[model samples]
Target: MVLYLQIIWLYLPIGLANIFASLSRHIFPNWDYPLDLGKNYRGQRVLGSHKTWRGLIVGILAAFLFFLAQKYFFNHYQSVRDFSLIDYNSVNILTGFLMGFGAIFGDALKSFFKRQKNIPPGQPWFPFDQLDFVVGGALLSWPLVPVSGVVILVAIVLGLLFHLLFKLIGYLCRVDKTMI
Candidate 1:
């Protein structure tokens, strides 16, 4: 539908950055480094052991490459270019690169808070689990892309739905240990 295309075109680059961070755990499990450096503040891990340097690297790299590819095609194809909300051809490449870092770091931040609250890993945290990366990605990339508020809101709604769907699929397929 027209709405679907518009929402996706507007949010795809940023969404990809966040999505790739979740995938990075599977792509390079060995590269995970605890962002907290295994130190606990008041008895809880800062960001936990799951937030790793490798995951950050993979997340940023994947998003940067995806953004570059989109930029290339948008520059070449009229159709692709027309659908883009953010100017791929002229926007800052750092926005795209930062998406990856932003998404992962966002989740890491959430993990820190979750730890503080004594929430266990892989546990369902309702919409928080779904929206963290989207919020993080959008906030970090906003300076460069500068999209409208409506776009971000719609993207958040879509992010929530997609997160639920993907988590369900992952659980059913045995790829994820928990279903949100």
Candidate 2:
């Protein structure tokens, strides 16, 4: 149980980034401008209309703040400090930024390939949508924290499960325009 939680805790920054990216788009419509700047690659949108600069920036900031909250909690509560998967006492700017920004970039990479395959934006792309952020977060955060294969596999599996569960909830509640 401890190991499972440690793995989940380690990956929460990326997961929150994914969720907050969607929330940022919904909350701040004015800021939702494309990172691609109406550009094209091979006569098609490079990353599609949905990949926005605001989402990336907001996602990164949200994850960093979440990390800061965790740091504060661990610092104040010495007993539960063992639950920390990474060094929460020290500033973890690089790890937070990598996990958060990497998640959006990961989604953009999938969108890139999805466009090449002629799949429209906001349409479901199965496991890729779920696993992309996890892969991106883990890969980019490797320099900051070299995790074991077991932890990586666990994080991927948990991410997939949570993604499916959240999408189901969103669909049932009629949350339209979501990238689930």
TM-score of each: 0.91, 0.91
Steric clash count of candidate 2: 0
lDDT of each model, Cα atoms only? 0.78, 0.82
Segments in model 2 whose C-alpha atoms lie over 4 Å from true places: 176-180
Clashes of each: 1, 0
At residue 78, what lDDT does model 2 achieve?
A: 71
TM-score of 2: 0.91
Give the per-residue lDDT digits (tens) of candidate 2, residues 1-180: 888888888788899998888788778989968988989888889888888988898888887787777777878987658777666655456788888988888888998988888888988888898899888887787777766777888888988988988888888788855647
In terms of lDDT, the best-performing candidate is: 2
The count of backbone overlaps in candidate 1 is: 1
- In candidate 1, how many Å is residue 152 off? 0.7
Clashing pairs in 1: 33-52
Q: Each candidate: RMSD to true structure?
A: 1.7, 2.0
